[model samples]
Structure formats: structure tokens, C-alpha cells
Target: MQSNFSYQTHDYFNFVFTDDGSVGLYNNIVGDIYHSKFGARTEAEEKFIKPLNFHKNFFKKKELNVLDICYGIGYNTKAFLNKILKLKYKGKVSIDILEYDKNLVLISPFINDSYFKTSPDISYILINLLMDEIFNNKEEVMEILYKSDNKKFIEPFYRRLIKKYEKTEYSYNPVSQNKAFLHNIYYHYISQRKKRYLKLPKIENFYVRTYFDDARASIKSLNKEYDIIFLDAFTPAKLPTLWSLDFFEELFKHSSEDCLLVTYSNSAAVRHAMIEAGYFVGKIFDNKKHPCGTIASKNKLLIENKLDEYDLGLLKTSAGVYYKDSGLKNSSQEILEEYSQRRKLLNLESSSQYIKRNKRS
Candidate 1:
């Protein structure tokens, strides 16, 4: 792996500082930020992490499996790692992440640590220590770093191996003790991905595989089942391939019986696609006045918060006809135009009428 990342800055991306003091990439072609302006890290935690109830789930099972789609900037995966460490989970985890753009992963290391910061606890303190050592300096890490144990708390590896500190290097071999340890494991994984398809270097208790190709095609070929699926792809309007009806059907095939598929989308089209694909869809509410995202699961009990009458009505209308990519062979324009023609033929009630009809009197 190379230490110099100066030449890897993507020309198609415009890095913008987000409201949460984190960096977000604005795709020139898509014309949207990779994450919401509310806060990239906060959004991942609230939408994906808390909704999953990872701590409770970790305690119930000796192993955990996750499928993170889009894997943009590695925020969702990094947040998951932080939460698991904070929970002091001692479980073996297998994560298979689908990322189409390799450049996003490459530039993630240079992203400020503020994006990784979360609420501080003893577990979080231990996480801070691991991160501090990984980056070699506390100052270079997140500003939220708290003073805590110097010994690393890498669970499932009870034995602590303390070694004399050495100058921090960005290469694959950063530490002398661990021949494979790098300053940042995720960053190392990205830097080592020199080809379109590459298997990531294994981390203790964590096995991650990155597929650098079209997600629609990749989802079909994946033989493994997922316990949790993170749908973090671009919006249907901007990138419809991943949100098509056909794509969700393929995802359903690869999902476990008890799988919880989560995404930051609450669009009627998105929800309709999930329901049409046989998933029991619900709203991933964070107790805000308005719901945040949607979570789909095989079990209805897993959905504590669900879509209201207005939403359900909207889904039945043309508003929820959804983009179609039959046989997974349609282009974005094709899917968009197909939905447009379908809506015209349905002659459905407007969204406002549905909202008015379902209004809570």
C-alpha cells in the first residue's frame, strides 16, 4: 500500500464540509452529497446503527453478519465497528460490503475523525484508544477522544500484546508487532484494492469482502445470506438501478429468514418496491416529529415503528408504482421512463388527496 494519497483525489467529486463538521462528497454526475447535510456520522448512527439494536443483537448471538450496500466512504461500516466495540461484543462477524466506486474508499482515510465520533462511554473510551493507536496520535484522531486504557480492547482476542510504540506509517505494515496492522484497517483495505475486484485483508473477528462492480449484477451472484442489509445506495431518482423492483427481489432471495433490511429512504416508490418484493416494511423512526428512514424485515415484530395510513395509501397509488428494471437489464433512463408511462396509464389520485384522506382528524 502506498503512503501518499495526494494523487488519488477524484476529479468527479467535490468534497464539501458537512453540517456535522464532517466531509461529504458531492457527486458531479449525481448532483447530490454522498450523505445528508444534517450529519453524515449522525445519520449513519441514527438510521442504521440504533435501528439495528446492535448491542442487544450481539448479546443474543455468538456471531453476526451484515451486508452494507453502497459502502460509501465507509461511514456505515465504521459506525458498526464503533458500536460493536462500544458494546464490548465478543462475537465473530462476517461483513460483505458492495461498493461501486473504489475512489470513495481510497479517500476515506484522509477524512477527518470527527465523522467517527459518537457518545463517549467506557466502551467508547476503549474504542478511542484503538483509534488513537491506529492513527498513532490522539490529536490526529477525533476531537472527541477521551482519556482511557492504553491497552487495546480488541474483543474475541483476549490476549493483549503490548509493543513499544514506533513512528506511524500509512503503509500496509504500520506496526512492527503486527506485520499486517495498518494505521487504519479500513483505509488499508481500500488502498490495497488495486483492482476492480479484490478480497480485503482479514481483521481479527472480522471478515470483510469488497465487491467493486455493479451492485445489481453483484447481488444476483452472491451466494451467502445476510442477517442485516444496509441499503445506502444513491436516491432512486439519481441512481435507479439499485432501487428497482427487480433488484429488491434479488435482495430478498439472498436475505435470511430473519433478515432486517434497512435503508435511509422513505420514498413511496422505495417502500412500495419493498412491499411488492414481499418484505414487511416499516418506518425507522427516531422519535422525531417526522420519521427518518425505512426498515424492512421478514418478521413483523421486528418493526416497532411502521408506516402510517397516509403512507400505506400513497403506496397503493401511482405514487408508489416504483421504478422497474425487469430482468435487471434496464438503464436508469429506461426505468424512469417506464415508471412515468405507468403512472400516466394508472390515472391515480394525487399524493395530496391521499394525504388529506388519511389525515388524523
Candidate 2:
């Protein structure tokens, strides 16, 4: 429950401001950032939230269950809460989040921006998690939230939102009032009108349980079936254990029949592994309506865009060779080494070769 790294010193949480003004953490060890530079909140909205079509599907359910793997800073979950709040969804929500680094969970609430500032419900959920899982007392949590340089970190982004809102006319429609609505909330929070501004009743139906452990082990212990699963792991080359066939099989077991497992990875190996795991896989389009990620489910009808011929052909190439973790106990190095050996032994056509052959045909 203790983190040796200090946020003030930028020792562990190497914060980077993304293109969309949201904060992201750079993992020096992984040589990558935790979120996309395109936009952290935007990525979560387009990749994870939009694809699920919660309004047409899950909103009808009396209770919704979600499992989020690799829950770094929880942008995906935050985006989810924003969408549901906008939709005025009343269904009970239960989320099971798995993250190996407790530090990320500890730092999540402090990393603020306009995107998160507007969504008070996210703050509420995150604060509750911090108290329930990280700290035993509310005083410790309040000290971190108020005493830390949180205001300094969020002020610039919050000002930008204010300027944007000032330029636009206020409207009554939800879509049109988005900026104005956020402006009001931000003003309330900054004005220290806590009694009048904080809306606890809005999120009373929301429940979140966070497991600070290896996702491989945590998934095994979860007995509940989830309606939606967000797999936001690192790339297949960087961390192949989570993308392995065995891992997907386990996910397939935990998934409800119509459950959609979404990830921001469009790797051929990752999609092939999902297919082999007995799930119907499809492509997830980005904001521009271009294919950017993969989605898988037990129900074929749930997949809107099925794999086309080119996609199916690519699966036969060397790039389609998936990593294996039979017992889910193998290290990343072991998985990568085993994958290399298997690729060489299979002698499958290279992805370039497949592309060139398709062009000739």
C-alpha cells in the first residue's frame, strides 16, 4: 500500500501532457507512454466506449459488469462514466479492475485535466477507490488531493476549458450545453462550494473493486462473468503474455455470451490468438472511421465488422503467429523467445509476401 516514488520529484510518475491536454505517464522501462499522444480521453472514448454502443445494448440491462485489464490511470473507465452520465443511465454498474502497479491507482486522481475536471463522477469513484483500497482514512486521501500540487497541475487545462466555454453560447440541449455544463462544474469546484457542488447521489449505483496484482492471476480468481471487458495492455511485442492464446481462452470463459472484449491493439498476432480462443473477432474503427483496434465476442452477431479477405489472409503470415503461455506462468522474455522459435519452425509466408501475392491476384 506504500509507494516509494514521489510525484513531486517526478521520480516514477513521469507526466507528459498529451495533444488533447490530458496527462499521460511515460514508462521509462517500457520505452513507451501509458496513453496515446493523439489524446488520452479521446482514445478511451473512441476505442473503448464508442464501440460498445452502451445506449443500444448494455443500458437495457438491470446491472452491468465490466472487467478492465491494465487499468493505468483509468482513462478508459473515466470515459465510460462520462458517457453513461451523459446518457442518464440508471443501471447499476460493477467494475473489476486489475492493475499490477498500485502507484498508478494512487496517482490517478491527482492527474487532472479539463476532460476529467468536467466529470465529477470520475473523481467520486476514484476517491472512493483510493480510500477503500489504498488508504484507511479520509484524512490521508484529503491531504493528498488538496495538499499535493493537484491545483497547479490542473489550472492551465481548466483555464483553457473556461476560455472555450466563454466563446460559445449556452444552450439547453445536452450536446450543446456540454462546454457550458463543464464550465459550471469547474467553477463550483474552484469556488470551494463543496456542499452545493458535490453530487454523491448520482454515483450511488456505481461499484468498483480494484485488484493490485498480476492480471494473469487476478483473472483466474474472478468468478463473475462480465458484459464488457477492456484489455488495454501494452503491445504484443512488448508484453505478449496477456495476448497469448491461453490468456484469451481464460477471458473467453469469463465473458458473458454477448460480451465484447475490446483493446486498442490491431496486431495480427493478437487477433489470431482471439480467433483461436473460440471467439468471433472484428475490427474497431477510430474517430475517423478507420480500423484501429480489434474486438472479440462469443456472439458473432455482436461483431459489426467481421474480418475481410485481406485480414483473414494476413492471419496466415508470420505476423499471425501468436505468443503462447500454456500455464500463464511464462515471463515476457520466455514468451517472445518461444514465439520466435515457433515462427521459424512454421515457415509461414511473411506478411509482405502475402500482401505482394494479393496484389498480383
Candidate 3:
């Protein structure tokens, strides 16, 4: 099982430090960062993993299938792994990841492990993913992760962040708390330098299969009814194809009866598409208990924060107009153009007008 992509990091492999002190990758091609600047791991834990209500759903099943779309640097999946580890879950976990760029998957293990607060078992899983998807064996993966100069990949970014923190005076806030946390982790990393050679955990029953192709094409090959679907696409405006009505319809076919499709998108267009595809949608609250994303499922009981009248009404405005890709075969530009033309033809009010009307009342 050899990969066609090379292991060498490219010139565009630039890393940016987020406000929460987690590393974020910038895609030169897309002109956007992969994770939110608020935090990479933070976004995954809060927006994706926490919203699952995992305690209610995970323990009920002996086996769980997860579909992770756009598995950028494997943050969402890694966050899930961290949570299940804390819970000491004994069930078999299978994940099918769809990522267009094989290069991103190859470099996933090189990201600083400390930022994730990964356990030894979690590190083993990251190494296993690299072994299965790119390398021939575990030794090759370990050599790159530990023995090679690749271990220094994140050092430059870490030093810059430390220096930036030294100069700034942060007030009592969440950002200050994150800065303190990173400082503690940095000190711990230095003290545990000798422990870097710890033995890897024996592989568990976790199964991961990665598809390096357009999600629209890769989704068709999936055979399992996924229990959880993490749809962390770029954005509806930048990449509408994945957020189209047809794409949601395809997801509906691949979902189990109680499957929860979670995404960091609360866009009216995206929600409208999900509702049109026959799924009941609701808001995903942040740690501060604010509506941060969307969660959709066939079972309405799974949604805790149901969309209110104002939120539902927003769908009827121009912002609620969904991107269309009939047969799931249109390009991004084509879909955006079609969506724009449709919005022009409709007599619906603008989203701004809707917001203003609600605020006055």
C-alpha cells in the first residue's frame, strides 16, 4: 500500500500560530488557513467533538463508524481519539477519511503532538495512520516522527510564539489562560526530552482508511452507514460544491438512522441545503454556550438546540438560498454562478433586511 504522493514538505507548507497557541496550516492555493485562528485543536474539540454528546451515543454501540470529510491534518479525528481515550472506551472505532490533498495527510504526524496533549496511545494512532496511508511500516513512520530532523519542524513557530507572549501583557481572559497553558506545556516538553523514546502502545482495534480524491467522488465508494460525519469543509462561499444540496443528499444516503452530521458552518445556505436534503438541523453551542455551528440528523431528538423561528426565517431570505450541484458533478465556480442567478431571480428579502426587521421587533 504505497502512496503516490511524496513525503517531502513543499514550499507552501507554512505554519501559523493561532491565538490559542495551536499550529494552523495556511493553504497557499486556497488563500486561507485550514483551521480557525481561534485555535486548530480548540475548533475541533469545541465545534466538532463536544457537540456529539458522545456519552449518550458512544457507549450504546459496540462498533462505531465515522466519516471525516476534508480531514485536514487529522485534528477532528485526533480530538475524537483523545476524548474516547479519556473515557476508556473499549469499542472498535472505524474511520473513513476523505481528503483531497495527500500531502496534508503525509505531514500530519509532524505537527507538534504537545499542542493536542496527546497520550502515548494517541501518538501511536497518528503513527499508524502515517504507516497505513503513506509508509511501508511503523519503523518508517517512527523514523520520520522521532529520529529525523523533522522533529524540529514546529520549533521555529514555537519560539516565535513564546517571544510574542513575552512582549505582550494579556488581561484576565480566555486568551491569557491559553497562553499560560502553552507555557506550562513548553516547560513540560523540555523536562520530558528523554522520555521521547518511550515505547509505542500496541495498536488497538481502531481502523482508518483514507481516500485522496474529491469528496464527491470518494463518498460514493463508502460502504458503511457512518454514525458520525464531521463535515469540516473550507466554507460555502469559497468551496460550495461540498456544501451543495446534492452533497447533503448524498450524505443523507450514507448516514445511519441516528447519525449526527456535524460541521463548523452555521451559514444559512448550508443549513437550507441540509433541511432540503431531509435532515433536521440544530445549532452547535460553543464552550460559552453560544451557537457556534450546526448539527443535523434524521432523529430530531439528537438535536439539543433546535433552530429558532428567526433562524428558520433566515433560510427564506437570500442568504438561505442553497448552492446547487445536481448529480453532484458541478465545479465550484459553476455552483456559485448558479446560486447567484437563483438568488437574483427570487423575490426573497436580503439577509441584512431580515436581521434588521428582527432586531427592531
Task: Give the winner by TM-score.
Answer: 2
Q: Write the per-residue lDDT of candidate 2 for residues 116-226, one digit (tens) a residue.
A: 546665655565545444333323333433444444554444334433433452442344254336536555664474445454534458888888777888898999999
Expressed as tens digits, the lDDT of each residue in 260-311 for candidate 1 is 8989898899999999998899988765756889999877877778777767
lDDT (0 to 1) per candidate: 0.66, 0.77, 0.76
The predicted structure with the larger lDDT, 1 or 2, is: 2
Which one wins on lDDT?
Answer: 2
TM-scores for all predictions: 0.75, 0.83, 0.81
In candidate 2, position 52 carries an lDDT of: 95
Candidate 1 ranges beyond 4 A from true positions: 1-9, 115-202, 359-361
Give residue 269's lDDT in candidate 1 (0 to 100).
90
Tell me which residue pairs clash in candidate 3. none
What C-alpha root-mean-square deviation, in Å, does candidate 2 show against the real structure?
8.7
Clashing pairs in 1: none
